[model samples]
Target: MPEFAISADPIFGTYALWVGTLLAIAGVILFVLGTLLKRDVSQVWLTYRGWLIMIPTLFGTVMLGRTASVLGVAALSVVSFKEFARATGLYKDWWHTCTVYLGIAGLAIATLLPDPTTGANGWHGLFRTMPVYVIALLMIIPVIRNKTDGQLQQVSLSIVGFAYMGWMFGHLGFLANSPHFHGYVAYLIFAVEINDIAAFTFGKAFGKHQLRSNVSPSKTVEGALGALAVAMALPWVLHFSFPHFGTTELILTGLIVGIGGQLGDLTLSFIKRDLGVKDMGQSIPGHGGFLDRVDSLIIVGPLFFHMDRWFHGI
Candidate 1:
């Protein structure tokens, strides 16, 4: 692996410049169109502005170094977990929420530390075992408080929050330690976001059949298929992102982003639908919240991580 420098990988810089240029052009075009038509582009601007900040922050942190990249991802995971906790009412119980936070922090720390056995940058052994320790601590919380009433719900919620939002999502951060850190992380994030946009575009254009009316009313089968088609073609289009990926790996990568990404989104949708909440929180203007924005990554991270690790030992 090359040293973690801003220009260590030309692909990274290329993507940053490309995405920045596209965002700039899109923003200007949208503004001009809105002005010409005398229409309200507030919502569109809000989303565009969010992307403007997020794109740079992402590129800057990842380019800083492996440590910075890992920490940035860990921070995002913590915020995401906070949103989940708040949405599920687990935030009211400081004991449960705090323990999960500690667990997430531990996962981040483990990712930062070198593997004791092989002296590798990240200790995969300890990182994978963190949930066991976290769950055990969550179970011990009730005993320490000497309260059994309502402990089950709190404990269950805490466990789910930490396991799903923290550790699983933290897999993306762990990938920073991989040899192809820049390519892998950047490709996954970019591909997943494009998958989201493709779904919305296709849905609006030719959507007549609802995918799951109960979970996400606006989602359509046509949109889902269109997103899948785009995702499946992305690997070939941007094969530079993973030049090492052969035919099988490329196919699997597409499937993971296409199917796994939507699954992650729907999983959060399931939670929101069950809780009867439209949005998780109002943290972001047009994005709803951190959890809402990163819901697609929750499942995709772990699935891609394991797949890459299994095939290439990354």
Candidate 2:
């Protein structure tokens, strides 16, 4: 199969076409609602506009082949970590922040390197163990600086930055090494984004009780369940994306995107609550930040990757 061209993968091309068509239809609907009903949808328009840019960029990157996709994901991890560092006051500590940056870079390189033992495309072993080396280095930073005061917080933040933002997010990049990368990468991303939309739409329509009042007051149990339902159903709906998957793999994929995706969002919410911030940053027009956009993938990526690997050894 051709790996470098978008037309090479029928699944990827068809999925992209469907997404673009849906977005166009959504735009028309939103325009009609605002024009005919005189309803205010400026915020929704902003979000729709963001998706217009993001979707194309994402599809374009994946179209460029494995190297481009891996590098693009790595760049995303870097920016996402930057947002986290800035929000958590870790950016002020150059040592910790820079080390985290290095760790993230290391992950990207690991994703691109050939396996030493098998001469395969990606160094899965090294990628899996990157966190260990990153954490050890984070722990030793204070020692090298000969400082004890505030070192605990610094080290902790550094470790979280590297492990969560770097390693966890890198799993998405590592997926590019798989032979079925075209379908796997596109489907996971599309599914996760749809899951977010489901949550918002459900919450607005039927939300009665808050899901986590302390962490995120806006989220609701109804919304979460609705999103989960959509996520669970998506695997079957998009079965063409992974024809090799059996019942077991399909169920696992559902759980990974449904439950794991929400858990990841909640994890970021907890961090934001403790940090006394609403959004990580205002990078994207309506998405809050890169971190906000990718929070779900932090958990979903690893879960999906391991599941796929367990079954397909990818």
Candidate 3:
């Protein structure tokens, strides 16, 4: 019950403790910095507010048990895809959007609902092949419409939306079945957020060379390296949460998150650039939308999940 121990107490190990302490520390820092800059503390607090809303929902469900955690991850997938569909104008295609909705729900069911292979757990073999089957369905559905106006575009968009959001995010939900899911899932979420803060902090302090001036101008080579280094070392601090993770596994997983996070950010930049939009949507005040905030976690989910699966046999 060490996993559930976090939700039970606010000061247990680094899980709840780190979350609450970090949230408090960041709020104070942002407030002071905002005062110094003559800015609205509430406006600055908006970013922290997002965390206030997300962390409990994320960690809370996980603490409730595997069913709740899987449902939580699946719910996030649907919402994230909804934002993607809206940004790309694919939501107007109701039938296509329905396909994505169904695909994601089906993926969630494949994980949560009873199955012959996994009994009460997710069936990994089906998840591995769901993309292919879903892709076929997307392509075939458009043909039934017999409309060539935006045939290829809509079909491709639907495929990308489902595959990226549903398949990749599904990996996160299935991690509930891992040996130490409490720690693995917690680290993935916590460290990825830390990675973002590190990148931004380092970028501001010592950033000179743009890592991707065209895609994400704010990112810098120095910031990326600094974030990577910090993320790689952070696992040691939380290693107690994941006692089975070897030193090498922890380091490699950290690198996976660091690099995958940057790629995830760039992937969204490409999307926004292609769509001729600034932010995906204004769902979270200053934080754009659910998709914007979670883009990094999306890629890292599958990468970390598969790596852990490979090394430890999920």
Candidate 4:
């Protein structure tokens, strides 16, 4: 009888790799679909499908826990920030937007540093570095004050632009740096995406009561409940299949991630509503822009990271 040899690598690694690959392929498909469907389909549908593709790609890449993942996120963040800034008219002064990009690049570099003991430390370093650089850049604003009538508005916009886009997106690096950060990327993506899908599916199927019509017309009470149901269900599945997270931990995580994801979506919607713009930008074809694609992730990342740290000791 011939002896059989088994691979040393566990099945989990193979599964994760497959998941990541599939996500990347799906992103490409969606991008193509968005391009081809531009005139034939409604922006809403295009945007929906586009996001369905892009989120998974980012989620999968982040899960790989490589330098490329960090760079990928930083690049996405910069594009999204630019889109939001442009839409809000906050970047009318091109210099402010440039300054923001500079700050984001600096933060990204700091986050990529070889070793950090804690996620919180990475965040602290990023937060500390950004303000100092931004402040130095802002000092130049007074000299350029003659260009704009309202000096305060320019200053305020600069600060808000950096804080909203750069700071929020930087949290991903922090999350990636966590001790048990190994699985966090997938966890965050699953929680946020599932919540969105549940809400949308339920709202379309059984949404009678409105949650916030003015801000986001499609959202409804039924949808919210549906999202909550899916959110709660995630723990049950994870508990038995993945020993890494206990039942109690999963339950807490699901709630925080679910709620935060929904909040992120609504908050971005509010911004779009205020700006009277249909989409953030045309970068992602149907998705509008990178910001639109990652809105929920932005909100959920920090909350989940901190919550997991507190609860799971990650």
Candidate 5:
């Protein structure tokens, strides 16, 4: 039998039971809700709510391990970058779209390949290969361009779109490979979800001052504080429950991750406002799109990665 089966903590067993129950319940509810309502739920609600269910479920199933989680993250990056490119009106050529997708596919495959035994250098080899793929696409842009007006604008947008959505999200693999993978992933999810939940609950109850009506009308100062409070409180709770994370460390991690999560939300909102769209896409019934759900994670992952490295000596 596997060692995990005989572990005293029953970590896997307990997690499976709870996760299965929740997913079954959620699946039924979503099905019923969709049928009864006969109308799709808000994208924001669907995206966040789905992740609230899916992330933990995946974690419990052992599918949320470093390798699997990073692959999921990379897949999301591809979707988001594709949407972003379309929104920004970049890559008019079919060839350009194909090229970008090909590069993304290559990166995704690289993620699933067995980790090289050459230590850090092996990882570096993977990273180096990604740029070469990207460069190949970049090199072909000139060949595809048909001397259209504002050529520079199109190329610039394409580059920025890829870098922001693809390159940045690819860093998830790097973070997953870090020493503090467990802590970092946990902290990232906790911070992002807690902050969003706290903000919404607080804003609804006692949001007198608007934070940004232009971008996100519902955001408020009260909600922001509420988020910060919960963000700060999580560390203390973790300390008491786990006894492994220290008080000072938790507090600092909470503050950084919480603030970063909020900023990410705001940034995404700004993008939506500029595009004059309500949600990113309709992939998830109530949720807008995968990008909408993982917007905060995009920022939180990198921030938490570096912070964990600094504090936990990872």
Candidate 6:
């Protein structure tokens, strides 16, 4: 991989610029149309403004360098886990919570090692092995605390929490370590966000059938199908990132990201429903919380990363 520099990968920069430009154009359109209809555009502007900050921060962090990108992912994982803990009231057990954060931070740091191609770049060996250590530590935590009561709930929650935010999001960070880190990292994340918008747009226009009325009523069959279509079709357009991908492979990749993205979203919805609350937090103005904005991306990283690894050996 070339050294992580903004100009090192022109293709990545091109696509990143386009993503921001397109959003800007859409914002202008939304603002104009809302004004004509005498509707409040404040919500639209709030979301537009949020993306204005998020797009560069997200794309630039990855563009500046490797370690910056990896650490950025680590920061997101920690914040996301914090949101999850707060929502579930899991923050009460600070020990278990901090442990999970430590696991995620470890995963992020592991990616900083240069790939030797023959030995441990930490992906196959230590990355896989460290989780076992985390598991053992989780078991030992309760013994040290000597709190038998609620041990079951705390331990289980910690294990799953680490698996969810720490493990899953860690996979996303690992993409930065891939040989094609220049393009692949940005492409993987950018696609998921697009799939989300496609689902919401299609759902509003022709969403008569509810995909899961109980779990997420706002989601519609139309939206899900739209997401699938976008996922399945997007790779052909982005084939420049990986010319090695044949049509079949691209389709599979799309299916993984598209369906996986919705599943990720629905998974968060499942959690919220079980908790009998709406929106994870109020961080974003028009959007719910930071977690709400990224719910679609939670499972997408692992699903896409593994699929890409399997087919393209990335």
Q: Which candidate wins on TM-score?
A: 1
Candidate rank order under lDDT: 2, 1, 3, 6, 4, 5
Candidate 4 — which pairs collide? Answer: 47-286
- Report the C-alpha displacement of residue 32, candidate 4, in angstroms: 18
Evaluated at residue 115, the lDDT of candidate 3 is 51
- Between candidates 2 and 6, name the one with more favorable lDDT: 2
Name model 3 segments beyond 4 Å from true: 1-13, 27-39, 114-120
Model 3 pairs in collision:
none
Model 1, position 98, has a per-residue lDDT of 87
lDDT of 2 by residue, 64-159 (tens): 888888889889988998999899888999988888889888998999999999988899999999999989888999999999998999899888
User: What digit string (tens of lDDT, one per residue) describes model 6 on residues 177-275?
Assistant: 676776676677778888988999999999999999999999999999998998888888888876777777788778878888899899999988997
Regions of candidate 1 where Cα sits further than 4 Å from its true position: 1-3
Please list the Cα RMSD from the true structure of every candidate, rounded to 1 decimal place.
Answer: 1.2, 1.7, 2.7, 6.5, 5.0, 2.2
Which candidate should be chosen as best, given lDDT against the real structure? 2
Q: Cα RMSD for candidate 3?
A: 2.7
lDDT of each: 0.90, 0.91, 0.81, 0.70, 0.65, 0.79
Better of 1 and 3 by lDDT: 1
Check candidate 6 and list the clashing pairs.
none
Among all windows of ten consecutive residues in candidate 4, which has the lowest summed lDDT?
Answer: 1-10
Cα deviation of 264 in candidate 1 (Å)? Answer: 0.7
Lowest summed-lDDT stretch of 10 residues in model 5? Answer: 1-10
**Worst lDDT window (10 residues) for model 2?**
1-10
TM-score of each: 0.97, 0.95, 0.91, 0.77, 0.75, 0.91
Worst 10 contiguous positions by lDDT, candidate 1: 1-10
TM-score of 5: 0.75
Candidate 4 global TM-score: 0.77
Better of 3 and 4 by lDDT: 3
